[model samples]
Target: MLPTLDARLTAAAELVLPGKPVADIGCDHGKLTAVLAASGKYPRVIGADLRPGPLAKAEQTLEHAGCKDRVELRLGDGLSVLSAGEVGTIVLAGVSAQTTWEIIEQAPWVSQVGGPRLVMVPATRHSELRRWLWEHGFALAADRPVQAAGRWYAVMAAEYTGEVRIPTFTECLFGRTAEWPEGAGYAAWQKAKLPRFRLGVPDGTELAEEIDKLLDGSPSQTR
Candidate 1:
């Protein structure tokens, strides 16, 4: 049996395409990379971060898990540690949207691959991050929230599509597609979130409009 992953790590795992290489940028504990490599979810994984402490921890974890050969722990800024075509999918999690966007901005090759994927979990300023990604030619593939520690957190998966398609404000805020088609499972998944949004949400404004659009599928309010 494998060690359990937290909600954010699980969300990142779901975004990674099977059979492809993956890199976890800012991979703090290296837990996510170790789990993915040990599970055979990907053929290769590079766990990278700017600091060495976390990288060392990740290396130890991967070694203990007997997946050291499959997982590489690198010390550098995002994407700088990996060469061209090193990994098909990249995850930038456990960081602020500002830092994450800066890394994405620096890595131009992100737009070169056929179907390269990016999984992001921004701790703050996510609206700015989404808008920046859309402006930079990424397509919003999947956007949803996961409950963790009595709080709901959003996850976004995007790909380099080389086109500028602005997501509606609602899509940008909550997510871009209500046609989620993941069926009752997803709706049930989202429904569980309604109460929290109702309870803690601030005065009626852009966020509320966007949330409404996410629920009702209205482009006018969302756009």
Candidate 2:
């Protein structure tokens, strides 16, 4: 039997394009990797982690799922485990936006044209991550709002478009998720954080006000 992925991982998995290989980075328990391998949609599957302990756990997951031969487990930091173009889609989850950006930045090839698609579920700072991706020559191709474990999360799928531009604050916060089914809940969750956020940043007050208008049912014009 294949491992059942949680709501977040299930959304991440759905964003992966078919036909090419996929890699699950920071695959803590390797449940997602095993599930992908068992699906047999992709020709190859890889599960990589920066730590030995997690990689070991992933190995066991593949074994128990009876898909050990279909998935390759690698031990390395971020994208270092695979060469550029080795996979068509890359999944990064269970990490903060800062850490996710650090990993992607270290792998310059991911920003190249025709690079693999990125499906990321940042544990925090979704706005910061969206803005970083836009300014760094990537575009938010797709996004979905997933409510799991009583909290809302955004699954961002981005691709290297080489169109480096600064996104508006609303665009950063909402990305392309406003039209999604669970977008309202995700927006509400983000809005609830503004007060605390306002306490820390210099422009937090203005930023909060701007987002407030959008969250008030005013349609956002984000790209």
The top-ranked prediction according to lDDT is 2
RMSD of each: 4.9, 2.1
Please provide, for model 1 over 1-223, each residue's C-alpha lDDT reduced to its tens digit, 9 standing for 90 to 100: 3457878679778888888899988888778888889878788888998999988888877877788888878899788997767788899888888898888878777776475688998877566788888888887787756656665556788888889876755445545434443323434455555557755667587666556655665233232
lDDT at 14 for candidate 1?
A: 86
Residue-by-residue lDDT tens digits, candidate 2, 55-112 = 8988998999999999989899889998988999999999999999999999999999
Candidate 1 Cα outliers beyond 4 Å, as residue runs: 113-115, 177-223
Worst 10 contiguous positions by lDDT, candidate 1: 177-186
My TM-score estimates for the predictions, one after another, are 0.78, 0.92
Once superposed on the true structure, which residue ranges of model 2 sit more than 4 Å away at CA? 199-221
Tell me the lDDT of model 2 at 72: 88
Alpha carbon lDDT of residue 49, candidate 2?
Answer: 92
Of candidate 2, the 10-residue stretch with the lowest lDDT total is: 214-223
